[model samples]
Target: MSSRPEAAELGFGDIEVGQVYEIERSFSATDVQAFAAVSGDHSPLHVDPAYAAGTEFGSCVVHGILLASLFSQLVGMRVPGRHALYLGQDLTFRRPVLVGESVRAIAKVTAKSEATSTVVLNTEIRSSDDKVIVMGTAKVKVRDQVRESVAAASAASAVPAGAARSVALVTGASRGMGAEIARTLARRGHAVAVNYLRSADKAEQVVQEIVAAGGVAMAFQADVRDAEAVRAMTQQIVERLGPPTVLVNSAVGEFANRPIAELRWSDFEDHLEYQLKAVLNTCQSVHPLMKAAGAGAIVNMLSQVVGGVPPNGLADYVSAKTALLGLSKAMAAEWAEDGVRVNMVSPGLTRTEMTQHYHERVFKMEAARTPLKRIATTADVANSVSYLAGDDSAFMTGVNVFVTGGQTMI
Candidate 1:
C-alpha cells in the first residue's frame, strides 16, 4: 500500500453548496498496465502504443473509468472524506487522457440532501493544459454511524416528518389489492391518486371512502398502456392534488387459465401490455418529477409465482411477472442516485376479487404449503408496499421483497 496521509472526514452538516476541492496527479504507462491487469481490459487502444497511434487519438488513451477513478479518490480522501459512501456516478468522457499526462480531479459541491445524507458534486478531470477530459456528477452518502443507526431504528415505526402529506399515485385502485394499497398509503399520511382504466364507479367509491376517512384522494381514468392518456391524467392529478412522489404499480388484467396450444401470441402480449407496459409509461412520466423533488419511491406489484414452481397454464402471467422483476431491478440501479427508489413486492396467492372464483381447494392447498399456514391477503401485500414507500427503506433498492408468508424463502 502507498504511504498516503488520510484526509479529514467531513460530516453531512459540514458539506455546503459551491465548496471546491481538487487533487493533482500524473498517470503513467505502469498505472495503465496495473489497472488493465486488474480490470482485464486489454483493449489495444489502451495498452498498445502502435495500435493507438493508428487511431484518431494518436496515443495510448487511458481507460475512461481509470481516469474517472480520480473522482473516487477525491470523494473518499477529500471532500466528504472517510465519511462518504459513493452511491453512483454519471459521466461524460469529453476528451481522452494520454498516458503520462498530468491531470487534476476537481470537485465542487452542487447539492446536499439531509434526509438521505447524500451530497451531489460536480466532478471533472482536466489536463495540464486546463482542458477538461472528463466531467460528471457524483453522489455520495455521508455516513455518521451512530446517528444513522438511531434514525433508521426510529424510521421503522413512523414516517419521516418531511414525507407527510406527500402525494401518491396507485394504478388499478378501483378494487382488489390496488384499493388496499391506496387506502393504506393515505392512512400513512400521503394524499393518494386512485387510478383505474374503466371502473370509474368503483374508483370513485374508493376515493369517497378515503375522503370520508379524512384523507385526500381522487380518482383518475387512464389506460396506462397508452402513454398520452397517462400523461393527461397525470397533469390533472398535479393540478388537483400535487405531483406524486410515490407510485404503486398494481395494475393487472383478469387471469384465465388456458393451455399453450389453445392460446394465441396475443394472449401473452395482452398480459405484458397490462403489467409491463403500464409500468413503462408511468415510470417514464414520473421519473423527471421525482428527480426534481429529490426523493421518490416506486413499489411494483409482482406475484410470487415467479419465485419458482410456477403452476401449469400460467405461462403468460408468469412470463410477464418475470420480465417486470428484471425491469424493476434495472430501474432501481439507474435511479438510486437520484434519491428515487424502485422495489418489487411479490406476494403469494392472495384471495382478492381476482382469485375469488378459484376453487376452495386451491386456497386450502396454497395455505397448507406455506409456512404460515395461510395464503396472503390484500392487506399483507399492501402493508409491505407501505414499508417500501416510506423512509424506513431509504437505503434499499433493487430488492424484491417476497411477501409470501415465508412460502418462497431463498
Candidate 2:
C-alpha cells in the first residue's frame, strides 16, 4: 500500500461518491476539424456554416459528442485513469453548441457502489454564456478500501458551524464569482469574510445567506486599492473570523468599453488602482498573518484578454490584468519559502451584470469566435477558484489558469 494521498496513489477500492471532477479545456479550430475528420461526424451542422444556416439551429452547430468528450479529458488522466472503466453515460442536449465554442465539462459524484467498485457521476457541459449545452451522467470503477473509507468519513463528518472550517477572505463578494466563491468557501467549512467595496447591500445579503445555510460568514467593506483601508479591513476580519489563511482577490473596477482614443489618463489609472493595486494591497496586508501561520493560498482574478485577442475597448482593463500576472509570479517567488502559494485565474468572458451588455450585443458573435461557442459563468470561474484556494492546489503556484472556453489556445 502506498502512503501517498488517495489522489496520487493508484487503486480500485478508493473510489467514493460525493467527489467532484472539473476541467477547463480549449478546443481549437483544428481540434473541431480533426474530431470531425476522425469521427466522420462531418455533418454540415458541425463543419459548414453555409449548409447549417438554413436549418432550425440557424448555424453550424458543434458536434454534441465532441463537447461530451471533455468529460473523459477531465477524469481519464486526473482521476481513476487507466484503471477505471467507463460503464455508461446518458446525455441530454439543451442547446446547440456551435463550432469554435470553448466548453468546460464538470462531473459530480452522485452515487457509489463501493462493493461493486463503481461510482456514478452527474455531468454538465456549459458554454461561455453560462448556458448548459448538454448534461449527462457517467459511471466509472475504482479500487481502494482505505481511501474510500476516508472519503466516506469526511463526507459523514460534514463541517458544521463553529467547527474546524478554514478561514477565507474573499474580495468583491457582492456579486458574480466572488459571491459564489464566498458561499462555496463557507460550504466547504471555511469561515468567510465576504469583502465588498461599494455594495454593502449585496455583501450583507451574502452574509445572511451563509448564516442561513448554517455556515459562518461576515460582510466587511474595504476598498482594496486603499492600503490603509485594506490593512484596517484585515484587522477587522481577523477580529471577526480569525486570521484568514485563504485570500481571493476578486475586486475589479468596471471597464468602460470605449476605444483608447476615447479614454483619458485618469481612466487608465483608475483601472490600474482597482485591478492591480488592489491585489498588491491585499497580498501585502495579509502577508504577515499568513507567514505567521506558515501556510496560505492567495488567488487573484485576471482576465484571459491579457493572453491575446484584444477586445474592442478594454485597453486599460487588459493592461492592468496583464500586470497582475507578473505580480502573481513575483509574489509566488517571494513567498513560496513561507509556504504561501499565489496564482492567477484569468476567466474568459463570464456572464455577469457587467457582461449582460455584451451578451445583448455580441454574445452570438463572441460565441462564434471561440472554439467552445459561449461565455463562462460566475459559478464556472468560482468553482475553479475554490479548488485553487483549497488543499488540492497545494503544489500549484505562479500559474495563470485560464478559465476561458478555449478562447486563447496558446
Q: Which one wins on TM-score?
A: 1
Candidate 2 lDDT, 154-270, residue by residue in tens: 534543535544679999999878999899888788888999988899999998998889888888999888998997887677544556789999987777788989988898899
Clashing pairs for model 1 are none
Q: Local error of candidate 1 at 274, Å?
A: 1.4
What does candidate 2 score on TM?
A: 0.60
Tell me the spans in candidate 1 whose CA falls farther than 4 Å from its real position: 1-163
* Model 2: residues with Cα > 4 Å off, grouped in runs: 1-162, 359-361
Q: Looking at model 1, report the run of 10 residues with the lowest lDDT sum.
A: 154-163
TM, every model: 0.63, 0.60
Q: What lDDT would candidate 1 get against the real structure?
A: 0.85
lDDT of 1 by residue, 1-410 (tens): 98988977887667766699999987788999999999999999999999999999899988999999899999998978888888877788988888988999999875554335566677899988898889877778878776566545554333333445478999999999999999999888898999998899999999889877767788999999999898777766654565678999999997799977788888889999988999999998777557656789999999888887898898899989999998999999999988899999999889889998999999999889889999898899999999999999998888899988898888
Going through the candidates in order, what is the number of backbone clashes in each? 0, 22
Model 2 CA lDDT for position 127: 79
Query: Which structure among the candidates has the greatest lDDT?
Result: 1
